[model samples]
Target: MKAGDPGDCAGYRIEFESSGPLLRVRVTGAGSYAATVDYWRQILAEVQARKPGGLLLVDELQGPALTAGEWQSLVDGTRQQGLETVRIAHVKPLGLQSVEHCEIYAREVGLEARVFDNETNARLWLRYGGA
Candidate 1:
């Protein structure tokens, strides 16, 4: 699906494309923590149902930075939602330095996740364990 194809998805515009072993997700909207998590669960559901090799999440949501607690909660929720089995490459939203913290929290909990400033690197990491 295209980015503008959807009107609103749980208060966010989410597009998903599956290519080979990768499930590419693009999320764009003025987002909040709760709404973000809701869409994330939807993405997780798709991943669980499809059983893709990896996930590339391009998050362009504009929102206030999440607190440390919120980041931990997101990571925990992701794990609890059964995404630990797949590698996740999260494209950090512009100006969100807190994404690194999210990656750290995810790694701490044994989630195979990484954060990147651009999609190229993210895709590279997802396809191959390159830095």
Candidate 2:
């Protein structure tokens, strides 16, 4: 099911799903740093509680609007929590700089992170265990 719009954060919606150890998150609409963090924290808590061995799939997200600090926080937090993988899917075009930054952060954190133009590919990569 989908998490209702936060209402306070430019109509952002957080959807959660679980398949065995995999946790899926879909964030839609404009969102502030605080809102994004809150959503991720909640999802992470659930993942920890479940103690899953699978990855995290984040879909339909707009990454360019996110500040570098916010991205770093997310990467660090997920890494610290020992989540096996994170795959983010962006519906819109992403700049080369943003892509490079994500790649670097993923490498630093030892998490397989990749940006995909399609949700299907992201899901496949996350499920099949690919960097």
**Could you give candidate 2's per-residue lDDT for residues 1-131 as a string of tens digits?**
32322223345666666776566666666655666677667667766676655444453445445657667876777767645544443322333334445556766877656666556766676668565
TM-score of 2: 0.66
Q: What global local distance difference test value does model 1 have?
A: 0.81
Question: Scored by CA lDDT, what does every candidate get?
Answer: 0.81, 0.57
Clashes of each: 0, 0
Best by lDDT: 1
Candidate 1 residue lDDT tens string, 35-89: 7787787788788777888999898888887778888988888766667788999
The alpha-carbon lDDT assigned to residue 40 of candidate 1 equals: 82
Q: How do the predictions measure up, each by TM-score?
A: 0.88, 0.66
* Span of 10 residues, lowest total lDDT, candidate 2: 1-10
Off by over 4 Å in 1: 1-7
